[model samples]
Target: MSTGQGRLIIVVTVCVAMLLAILPMPDWARPFRPPWVTLVLIYWAIALPHRVGVGSGFVAGIVLDVLTGALLGQHALAMSVVVFIAIQLHQRIRVFPFWQQSLGILVLLIVEHLFGLWITGATRGTAPALQYWAGPFIGALLWPWTFVTLRKVRRHFKVT
Candidate 1:
């Protein structure tokens, strides 16, 4: 796709992701709410490394931070790390089967969650419970579908 069209798609997807990030959940399900922005970032970084990287991640995170009303840089720091790791392994991970790519996404989500927890603990407080750790698994479980849908979007937009 043309660079302008590719960028528009990115903006649209990121806006949708930001909306998902702040949407409220029931108390019982709140902890399972996956990091939507992070998942989107992971997919884009892998699919089009040239267009999505640390800077995109940081900008996405800051937008997320604003959306969620969290301390500035919380998502920024975590997402920057997540993007770095994804970019580092994208060459290898992209060749893996879907299932294997999902596994890689699982690891990346877990690491992102841990970084978020550490930052939370340092800046405010963290909940020490399985619930706090559950989002990654849910995110992993959703990765296959997420990847498939995003791949379709990329193809439809003819993004490079």
Candidate 2:
């Protein structure tokens, strides 16, 4: 694909992930909502570390913060850290089998949530309930499907 096309595809996917992140759900299902933006960022960071690294994560997270009305740099900081780790381990992560990859993704998601939790506790003087911790597990559970779908899109679009 052309440079512009490849960039466009990545941007579109990130935007879609952001949309999914903010989409409304029933009260009971809210905590189970997977961290879509984090998953997508992790995928791109691993798949194309050169093209999408910490900076991309920061930008995407900033947009997500604005969309979700979060503390200004909360998501940005968490996402940057997550993407940095993903980029650093991209090679090893790429070689892992699907189940192993999901385990790795779970670690990354847990880290992301930890950062968010830290920021929330520091700023608001309170922590979210137990339900807040469910998102990462759900995201991890969905990783295989997400990885497969994104890999297909990357290959089909020839997004180098």
Candidate 3:
């Protein structure tokens, strides 16, 4: 794709992720909600490090903060950190098998969650329950499919 087209694709993907982040879920299912925006950010960070790195993550995360009415920079900070890691290891992790990639995704999600917990606690909040950690597990479980689908989308769009 041309540079403009590739940039458009990135914007569209991030917009879709932003939409998913705000889409409502059932109360019981809320705990299981995968961090859709983070997952998408990770995928792009890994697959298109040059085009989608910390800046992209930080912008997406700030949008997330606004959409979710979260602390101003909470998700921004966490996502910046997570995407930094993904970008750093993108080359090596891209060579790994699906299972390994999923494991890496799990770890990244956990890191994001921990950052969130720390920030929230610092501002005054109790420790979240074990179920609060379910998002990472669910996100990790969805990694293979998410990877394949996003790869296909990027390829179809000819995103660089």
Candidate 4:
């Protein structure tokens, strides 16, 4: 594929992820909503660190903040940190088995949430309920399937 095509595929995937992030859910299911944008950014950061690193993460996070009506730069800082870590460890992570890779993803997701939580607490002077932490766990559980699916997409489109 041409360079522009490859970039377009990545952008499209991220846009879909952002949509998923903002999709409506029943109140009971809201806390369980996986961090879709974070997961997509993680996949790309791991698969193509050079092409999608901290800048992509920051931009994705900013868009996500706007889409979700979240505090500005909240997701941006969190995502930049998460993607930086992923880029730093992508070589080792790429060699891991799926299960181990998921574990790594779990760590990254937690880190992202930590930053978010800190920002929330700082802004609102209140802590979220325990359920606030559930999304990362769910995201970790979904990592294997996400990884496989995105891998197939990348291969199909010859995204490099």
Best by lDDT: 2
The reply for model 4, stretches above 4 Å from the true place, is: none
Q: Give the 10-residue window scoring lowest on summed lDDT in candidate 4.
A: 15-24
Candidate structures ordered by TM-score, highest first? 4, 2, 3, 1
Please provide, for model 3 over 36-125, each residue's C-alpha lDDT reduced to its tens digit, 9 standing for 90 to 100: 899988999999999998998899889899999989999999999999999999999999999999999999999999998998888867
Worst 10 residues of 2 by lDDT: 18-27
lDDT by residue (97-145, candidate 2, tens digit) is 9989999999999999999999999999999999998999999999999
lDDT tens digits, residues 48-144, model 1? 8999989999998888888788889988988999999999999998999988888899999999888778887887775558788888888988988
**Which residue pairs of candidate 4 clash?**
none
Q: How far is candidate 4 from the true structure (C-alpha RMSD, Å)?
A: 0.6
Q: Residues 66-135, candidate 4, lDDT per residue (tens digit)?
A: 9999999999999999999999999999999998999999999999999988999999999989998998
- Poorest lDDT segment (10 consecutive residues) of candidate 1: 121-130
Residue pair clashes in candidate 2? none
Ranked by TM-score, the better of candidates 2 and 3 is: 2
What is the C-alpha local distance difference test score of each model? 0.88, 0.95, 0.91, 0.94
The local lDDT score (0 to 100) that residue 143 gets in candidate 2 is 99
Residue 11 lDDT (model 1): 84
Better of 3 and 4 by TM-score: 4
